[model samples]
Target: MTGRELLRMVAAQVCVHGVMTGTRLAAPLLALQIGYSAAQVGVMLALFALSPVLLALSAGRLADKHGLRLPMHLAIGGATLGAGIAAIWPIFPVLCVSALLTGAAAATTQISMQRHVGRAAKNTSELKAVFSWMAIAPALGNFLGPLIAGVVIDHAGPEPAHEWGFRAAFAVLALMPLITLWLLRGAHEAPPEPSEEAPADRSVWDLLSVPQLRLLLLVNWMQSAAWDVHTFVVPILGHERGMSASTIGVLLGVFAAAAAAVRVVLPILSERVPEWGVVLVSTVVAACALVAYPLTPGAVSMGVCSAVLGVALGAVQPMIMSVLHQITPPNRQGEAMALRIMTLNFSSFLMPMLFGSLGAVLGVSGLFWLIGGLLVVGAPSVKGLRVDETPHERPGDPR
Candidate 1:
């Protein structure tokens, strides 16, 4: 893809994914405002990830077969409808449904987009650069979504109910996905390679037999759990500390902004930086930051911690994606990407509820330490990853 086309793809992703991210903030806060318990709110948050866990493999296979156009259309429609439902209803039950819709939509968009972009690269360097550029969508979406929702929630009205504020935020989120549809106008889909098709007898599980891919997924799960803990716990922690909606949003936004900032520079350094080294350092830093997160005393201190964690986690995806595209086969990349999404969302689906129940007993600080400790344990595995190796190549085989 040309730079302009690549940028358009990124913009499209930001719009669609932003709807999901924005709702993630707005819905949980609304439930909390309505006096739901953190555990209940956790259930609601878990719903966002639920559909993706079940549907990701199907979505990936769909992308592999149909390419971007069909999948993007489905994603745009689902996200728009999902947020619109919450905008109209604005209740806990409706919000759960919205979460399911938007989460699944975001996952579908990501698989299709990532597969498309990975295929566009001519070499490993381009793969790194392209994925780095694409990875910024989530960070930017995270920043924009929460910032918008938080500001609207804080200022939409003085109505004692705070109902209008949340409704307005959902309404705004509903419209954001339309921009993605517009940006995708006239986009081209590459013709499928006959050899790229997996046989009907093939199962997605076979991809896991590759040792490098398995290690990568394990490391990714650890990093993703850290992210889930931050996203799931921060609001509860901030709420317990009696911070305002805007303050919490800004804290989350700072993390995303830091993430986006790091990604902006990653493309420039893609040639110099080894993907494995970056992943290793990022994993270590993220572990440390998560451990330190709960100790921050106030918004400023928490924001500082958030930024540090953001930078560490933000640098991870491009490297992982680059290495992933290198190690996996060209034909089955979608299944591999889907498998990664399934694993992460499975954690996302469970971790919040797990965090909620655990948070009730151990407190949010303890939850942070738990994930951080796991990452520390997993850090050594990063040393084994090498992009030069592929799943198809047996040990000691001639190139």
Candidate 2:
């Protein structure tokens, strides 16, 4: 992709991702205001993730069979409508429906963007770089979105903070995607048309047929599940531990910035290291950090561990995306990308409620200890990557 196109895509990524997940942090607050218990709050968050987990592959197949722009446009509309629903009504059933729509919209957005990026990426390394650099967008967006929401929540009541904030955020999600469409104006579609060379069966199940692709999806699933533990659990943990709202906000911003900073250089660094090797090392590093986090002296020490955790955690998605791009045919990029999203969302969807229950049983420190242990157990799963892996994109395909 041209630098200009890259910039536009990154910008859209930032806006959509920032809003979609930033609301996750606000969910507990919303739940509390709406008369839900802590467990209910976690359940609410996890419930939203179900559609993406179950349906992303089909969405991907649709994108693959058809095209990228159409799904993306529809996703933007879904996001807008979903957010509007939340803004207008904060009743129990409405919140559930709105959250589900938001989750579906997020899936729609991911399928479109990943397919575009996968089709556009010239090589495995470039794909990795594009995915990694794209992290900067959401990393930045996560920082801004919460701060904006926090300000609104603190000023407006908690109800307005969540209900209206989602409305405003989705309104912005709608506008940002529109700008990306405008920027991509006159840009021809890059996903390949089906021919004898590419398989005609581009179903979600087709996404599962390839063993190498299956491994990649597993990696995506595990990595997302690991990250969700922190994203959904940390604020709750912080609140329980007597951390101030401002401090929680500051720590979150720091973590996002740290993650972006690490990702900025990972694209170049990934070139020098074998992809599988990078995964191995990153997992180990992240595990060590998480293991240390619960044992740390306090928040200062915890933030330090969190930054280290960010560096390690931020590397996984791009590495997997790069590999997925390599194994997938250009024509099937949408299916492959959507399949990964589906898997990731599926593993993550149940995390919040499960973790909340565990947290309730185990206590906050106990929850962190369990998280640390899970990472340790997951370390052994990082075996060698596919045998035919290419280190970088070859010029034959088109850069």
Candidate 3:
């Protein structure tokens, strides 16, 4: 693909992911609108995540073997349709089903894009920069999604305004995948070669022979769990603290803005900072911030904590992808990345439910504290990732 086409693809993905990030605001309120309990919301989140978990590997393999455009088109259509359905009538059960459809669409988009990024990128540094910048769209989306959704939900007046609220929000989201499908059309297809270990019988264990791959995958899973717990926990926390839906929306916006800002500069900064050091220090600090969040006096204090935590959350994806690109060859990148996504997503299902149930018993403060401790536990595992594993192109020098 030409550089222009590549950039167009990236732009399209930004829109797609931006809407995806923006839609995060929709779910909590959608739960509330439908009168689903916190536990049910957690379950819905898990079930949604599970769709991606199940499909991630196969999606990646398919992208590698075929063209990204076709699967990407399908995924975008699915997401658009799913968003449309969820907005229709907003019943509790319908929303849950919408979660499943949305999750599948999101997972497919992820795999298709990653495969394209790997294929289209000219070098390791460019790849890292692209992935890091790719994250910026989500942060911007987060800011936009909740702020807009909140206005529609809180201020929009008519009969059945809540339904109007989500319909408006989802209508915006449905537009994103079309952009992705259109942009993907311009991308040059790079079909992957059969792997050296392409035997039909290769077990997951056998396929994951690289030591770094295993470690990275596991750390990412833990990271995902902690991240998800915070996502579900934050809204519930706000409810307990008596914040309105609009206020919660603003906080989510701030958090996402912080995350986006950090990610925008990450690729440039990675050259100067150690890759593992970046991940480690940020994660540790984020954990401390999260631990303090619920204990804070009120919304303002917690908002500060959430923003700090967002800064840390922003650091994760590019750094992890950098490390992944470093160790895995291009041909295996698809499967490896797919596995990483799957593991992260599978954890997304359980962590929210686990944390929410515990919070019901222990209270929000206790839940945050527990999640904080869990983040602490995760920090060490990720912190120690060997720098020697970095790809030769962008060896993030620790010093």
* TM-score per model over all chains: 0.84, 0.82, 0.79
Q: Relative to the true structure, how large is the alpha-carbon lDDT of every model?
A: 0.86, 0.67, 0.70
Each candidate: RMSD to true structure?
Answer: 3.9, 4.6, 5.3
The list of candidate 2 runs beyond 4 A from truth reads 22-43, 87-92, 149-177, 191-203, 232-242, 357-374, 386-399
Which lDDT tens digits does candidate 1 get at residues 144-224?
888788888888868632899899889999999889999999777766665565566667766777898899999888888
Q: Which ten-residue region of model 2 has the weakest summed lDDT?
A: 390-399
Off by over 4 Å in 3: 1-7, 14-46, 83-97, 141-175, 189-197, 239-245, 360-362, 387-399
Question: TM-score of predicted model 2?
Answer: 0.82
Candidates 1 and 3 compared by TM-score, better number: 1
Clash totals, every prediction? 0, 1, 1
Q: What is the lDDT of residue 135 in candidate 1?
A: 94
Q: Tens-digit lDDT track for model 3 on 16-130?
A: 5545554556766778666778777767666667888888887777665565766777777777777777666566776666677677777777667766766666765676676
